[model samples]
Target: MSRTHATPVNAVDARLPASGRLADRAAFEAFRAAATRRWDDLWSVERMVVSVGVDSSSLAKGAVEVLAACRRELTGSDAVVREVSGNGALWMEPWVEIKRPGQPPIVYANIDPSEVPALLTGSLEERALGVRDGDAFGGIPALDDHPFFRHQERIVLRNVGVIEPESIEDAIARGAYSAYFQVLFEMSAEEAIAEVTASGLRGRGGAGFPAGIKWESGRKAKARPKFVICNSHEGEPNVYKDRRIHEGDPHRILEGILIACVVCGAERGYNYIGGEYPLAIQRFRKAVADAERLGLIGQDVLGSGKSVAFRVRTGGGAYICGEGSALMFSIMGVRGQPRTKPPRSVEEGIWKRPTIANNTETLANIPDIITRGGAWFAGIGTEGSKGTKLMTVQGPVKTMGLVEVPMGISLRTLVEDVWGGMRDGSTFKGIQTGGISAGPLRDDHLDIPVDFDSMTELGGMLGSGGFVVFDQTVCVVDFARYMTAFNRYESCSKCVPCRLGNPALVEVIDRIRLGRGSLADLALLERTSKHIIELSLCGLGQVAPMPLLGMMKMYAEEFRAHIEEGVCPTGTCPISVAPSALVAAD
Candidate 1:
């Protein structure tokens, strides 16, 4: 796909004067009023609007061309064409919306530039376009009314597709920094921590650690030059929730960071994002600069007598860097490897001082937690896992995209209701939750709640809310081999068990796949898996063997058939005829 130079329509121009930047309360309100008045005008209404987000920009460049073409053709029609954040449904990219003054917005997905002229003139056939829906407000079947969105309880993703990502005015109008201001002026640092603790908010970064406890430790730790880190290095395959937030709602994240800094009494902050997410990095950089210009993140923030410095650091894209200690090491200008936990990051972190590290989603939830109060936030999800979770569903599902569902939601409901079941009427087999690190769960396990404890009880962990579905055509053995190989390759080689055992595990799985395995090989595989799990230093080494072990336990009959019959039951693996012929000859 071709890259387009699409800037946010609400982005503050660099050439503008200081007063025009709208840094203060009066200036921001003035800007909001003017923007709203312009939109509310009836005589000169902007007839058509085309908004493209990171997902669409990555998936369909043709939509950008379509937007440009529409702008040129409708120059006389007073139409507006601009880039906006995606609605989290990545499958419907290059999503276009047409709005008249009084009529509901006309939504079209996967739009191409070639269809621009016809669409503007109302001459295009709706069936030919990709996922068309109209009359959003008048009850004419809008995108939000769809099951994929209707069932979701959006908290972090509330402002994603609704506002321009770079528009601070729009974000503030929608209550972005209100929480930070509340925390700064109304509540004391201890009060803030107590509120979060009372709300039962836990970290969304797979560990399920309580956020309040971490903050309290940072606040009380006897260290100077404290720091806060936002972990956006989402290296898991097919997981893009953090990237989406960074791209679509950069200000929300910044606000959350500011709140954390205030509550933890930290003056320095770092946003450690993955190097692969160029767009997210760009947006985040702009958001920080914009916030600084507005006196929200620098010296004497909002005139509240507090100062904080923030920087953005790009990781080397190692999966292990997602670990807290490993992320800190990368920021300290060293190799991205996990460190042993004793002092922990809260007590001793970057520069041997107190630090608080949180994932992008975890930090993003802070603003809401402060604004709504901890108890209000806690009342939403299950008894243990409070609040909502942003999940990325891929693989054989009919509708593969990002979804924000409440905690304790069953996997069966998510797959059948939200995703509309598997594609091509395929039978459901299993799903790999929490990315490749977590083990796969069979169809029978679908009814189990997807909270942290429930998933852990079933030998799976919600390792950042990645749910990849598989169909009947998928072979569990082959899938296990693929996941194991990924972990082996991405291992940081910091520990002996992971560095050596991962490749050995891959070799054993390959031997079984080739119909050359025995019961003795299975015993060796189990022993090696246990050794890797117990002896490894960090999470990467410890959880590396989960997929392999899960498949061995869940699909024992399939493995037995591959060994005794020398054939793959699902026909996904190629079997050698020589093994069977040799056995017959014997």
Candidate 2:
């Protein structure tokens, strides 16, 4: 289905103004009103309507005007423009086409949501009258011109919301290889690290460690045959930011890794992906092939005197794989488990070589930093954090999708304003930030800015952009237990503390929920939790107790009621069905 060529504009991107593509609300409203008036002029012949994304057989609201403008500019007369409502949601509906005096109107095909209520449900007096089978809706008409889309966006997320994942050329046009080209042609080993350092970018896959620091460590290490690893192992339960980046912008990650290889003088780079992300793996593999075909991944890239090869390595669906050292072990065909520090992955990584392991998002940021000057890239986010952060807004929100926002924005704004607040118009209860490792925050804490240090102040670190919101109805005790169970399952059994600690902790919580718990059970949980946090081998085990600990501090009554009366105050636990545990009448 050929569309009448309209470009898209992301309403939130700050770069839009620089490119002169930002649309004023009033001008856009005028365009919409004019389009509606044109529809009123020809309400009889056309019968159907639709809209879609810019690339996937969809039209911008301005596409209709562009079409009209094109017709008038070329043919110089008014085309009969009839708007018609289609049968389904706007994404699936067909575009309602206008007909020239005697010509028949034709509706375009394959709209995602076919329902077009705006044009269909009105009397002429009420201003809702639409043409028969031609009424359409969901049109944002100000962004149809192609020049609005010409900026080169680098954050390993260049392809998202811009092109269909299946399209290959979209990646090519987005400046995906400029960094790789620089690494191969313009930069030497130390020079590449210097450029990255100049960018002031940190690892976006959480930890917020400086990317240049990691690269510098690996570059300066004495170990021969250094390694560069792309950590695609997204093990967080609700986190999907990495998976989307790997799937949609594979070349960006590839380019980043290639740059790392050049800077560290390593001959090989490995992409370690999580087992659960099947679609991500498939898309990345195809992207690898596509990059190789274009001389971006393999030997002698773009006629430059540098060559490095890369491959995909899969992790066995373990949350621990997101940890840097654990991923290195998994890449070496061992169980995905964390190792002790003193010799970090930078000094001694896979096969005991000088390895630089970075998360998928961090690597994705490299190309853009190098291609665009570091100062230019650094100016986007807040002062400390120098780039836009990608976050997955899910659970009890009006719009549940991937979004990238600047660092200083408050969490409340992200939840209440950006996501349109709670789901189903329900009251906002709490939010679980940073997956299982993150602490839960009630409504009062939502105002915390979502940067690394700010979130940590509220007992929640910016773990990995997984912002799972809950409404007032969700039970805190049940939520803790559910998360505790996940921690138990994902614990790498290398250490006795994490292995024995998580399961034992799960059982204690289970007993409390079952009405069989004693007051002593709470004491045991308190002591055992402290021991686990202090004695666990790696960050996973240390952080696993966070949810339970947070609940004990934030909602202690919920826990106490479960243990003291066997009745879940929130009515969440199945064992709360019994009545004897309830306090007898005094």
Candidate 3:
């Protein structure tokens, strides 16, 4: 945003650092002090801030009109109706939060224009979700105690509902660049990488590789102009965590990027977001520009003499582009297809230089790791998988929303407790972890701790942390066929296994779904799925058949019902025993 459009609420005042480059901690402290005062003023009885959740999810549910309604209603009042980002409450959107002078901020959900009056007048009791700090608005529970949000750790989403997504001041007031500032003045690159490594943050983008190990490789390489890329172009079905972070907590992601740049000595950084996320892209673009103005990201960042240039590259919404090498391919202006890696991305990535690619959620953890020492983060979660994970629990879950919980929590806890179980009295069937290409975990597997090794031990990749919960209304065979079809449609066509094997698998499942399948076809599916996993060139192909295998292995009775009885056990698939032509040919 330009100076003309800047207001006292969003703009930086003269109390900040005199130069774009900060010389010492004292300068930053001055800025923080001013920001704190301004921030506190917004919540005071004198001013009374009415922050509206104006994120992408809320906007879809008519949040703009709600915001407009708040502005119209509080036109002459001392209350300030400001726009804040979403807290990932998808089912409870159009949130209206009012911070009364003596009381804590009360959050009311499903707030429409019609409820804006009741909200300001404190008559909106039924729409109340909870309170951020509980003064009891009609006895709604505290968010810290809410069933859906109680277990969430909230490191990545710390500023989500607290700050304006577009306001750098709001971001700063809530401790955005403090970690980066600390890193610039307090720690060496080696020490920085050690902090992350000690924190045990694995890559949140599919392969759960240790992030510190990748940074070490990137730093040790005898290469010039190292690069850091944030893969926000998540194309997995029913996964919206990346877009949610990008749109709601963009500065957090950017701060993580800057920290990575400092550690890896990268001169350039790229946030490869998908084009489908227009709001995220727009907000991120503004974030980059604003940071450059504030000297947060430039040749000499905050006078630390460390230079970093960051840019945003939007993809054309290809699922394959979510893969690391395929993302590198897209960024290079080439066909977004995966290539075999010997010289991994850390050794040779975009433009064939040493690069470190971390996904949106992975990088978002960096700033926090730096702020509160590495050991602090390592203390959370299970022994192997440390720290928290930002997860999107979708499908028919009762309280479907984005949650940040420590790793090693069972899917049973996530599905039953955090997300409030199945919606509409639906019986639990299974779950699809990661993308459509991941696990369709059964009821037995619900007790499995949701860590990388545990999920992988069950033959599923915990990629992207997007869990698609299903109920008894879904047929395992039908779900496998649909997921296989998705893989078929999204195959990059570079390799035969993904391109050809997906269609072949789709045909077999289709036949079974339509009641034309023989018992022999199940064996054929098992063989082909294994074949795809073994000979596939990339992660997409490698995991494409997981759904088929998961259903076949875990829910064999369902497949048996489809083939042997010529019927769907759940009565979800449309069975037609008509003779069909072979889909064996190209």
Candidate 4:
């Protein structure tokens, strides 16, 4: 399942922007003019910035509108397209030089329709724009159509949705290789670790382990030819953040992966993206080629004389592959089953050499941290979970998409305020957050902060930020059964707990849904869940029982009603007779 194909040059310039040497102002103008001259179907060439709301959930539609407008306007005309950040929009027409990250895209300062001579005379129009502050709205005169600006403190995900896929120049334009360059040229391996440690970026791949701790351990490990693995195989359903980043911003991700290789003294790295994400595979492969052509990846990058190589490896549609150890095994051509810890991935991983495995999101942040100081990055989010998180908020929500928000915000704020409240007027039943690994949350838990520690206490951990909400009509029993069946289907048969326990749990839920369960059955199910959670070797088994346990805890009456009254309270059980059906006919 290799999607490694050499990308044709100019395909990028045709599709997105002119990369490489054309990144400069003069080259940008020359390339833009040349491309525009070749294509005669040009329409208006005015610089337009389409703002997608600051929320991650706004990305899909926001991206669609921005692209649709860009296509509608620039389809025939080869215009200079650049992205600006002042307005949360993907600026298509080159209003400002968006060659750098952290800096806002140029805004038209002191614009006067009075100066229509440039437009009337057909002369090049020049406008100066300043970096507008957040509070600029209150003080500055707000234009009727000025784009809404929203920006979060970024370190890990600086280039995610901002950059074009596979464009090394785009990544560089977003401060891509600067982190590795800094590490290679300025900072020692220890200094790099200290910077990340100070930044307080916990692993975004469900495991909230501190990134610096992982690096320190890997650095201290006594293994030569160490390895680093970029875990992009996002097995969690509903979580599209990683896939989107991989498809939309592969270069920055690779930059982070390469940084890990340098910091941990690793010789090789693998980007383990799942088979489900075909677009991601294509984009990442193209990005790799683009990076190589620009001397970003492979053999002595950036005149450091340090050789590092990488390959994009696709998994066989296994959720277990997301587990760090299993990811390493999959890269080594073995079944994607996780091994035991103690001699963790740090001490012995891919090919049994001390290895460091990080999620795509985690790797994505490295460049920004390197470009901007760690302290600058650390200022966002809570003290514990410093920096932002990419959360995929789907199901029972008006705005169902990905969002990057500062940690420590209440779940209530995210669900109600940010997501535009649940789908409709239907009262929020609960949330199935963190995917199958996480438990459910009731209304009472809304105040729970969205950081790693707070979520765990409320029966849900931040597992890849796949938060699926269910409205009032959702059946907790059916929901639990659905999750149990999912675990049963995906469970690797490497262990008896997950292999047998998952199916057995599913059967228990099915029996209860069929009105064949007793109170004792619930007790037995609880015990079974305990066994699975405690004895399972990998993350799958440990978290398979989460839905069942959480549902039982949150809505025990729902299950009891199914067993006692032979009625699914939420009217979801297939076997349950409707009130209308039970009513006597004349």
Worst 10 residues of 3 by lDDT: 1-10
Residue lDDT tens for model 4, 1-586: 1112122123234444444532223443444444444232111222222221112223322533443343344343323343322122222222222111232333332222333234223232244233333222313322222322132333444554455454455555555566776777778999888889888988998878899999899888887879889898888766777877776567778888888988888888889989987767887898888766655566766566677888889999888888888888888999988888878888889888899999888888887777776897799888788888887676767644456778887788777766657655777889988877878998889998898888787678787888888888888988888888878888878999989997888888777877788889899899999999999998767888987898898898888899888888878776575433422111
Give residue 461's lDDT in candidate 4 (0 to 100).
79
Rank candidates, TM-score, best first: 3, 1, 4, 2
- Cα error, residue 386 of model 3, in Å, equals 0.4
What is candidate 1's lDDT per residue for 437-498, written digit by digit as tens?
A: 77878888889987878887777777789988888887887888888888888889989999
| Global lDDT scores for all candidate models | 0.78, 0.64, 0.82, 0.68
Predicted structure 1, TM vs. truth: 0.90
What is the full ranking by lDDT, best candidate first?
A: 3, 1, 4, 2
lDDT tens string, model 2, 381-416? 777777777777668776455666767778877776
Name the candidate that leads on lDDT. 3
Candidate 4: the clashing residue pairs are: 41-76, 42-76, 42-77, 50-89, 51-89, 56-402, 56-403, 57-402, 156-365
Error of 1 at 85 (Å): 1.5
Q: For every model shown, what is its TM-score relative to the native structure?
A: 0.90, 0.75, 0.94, 0.79
List the candidate 2 regions with Cα displacement exceeding 4 Å: 1-156, 164-168, 564-566, 578-586
Error of 1 at 505 (Å): 0.5
Best by TM-score: 3
- Tell how far residue 440 is off in model 4, in angstroms: 0.9
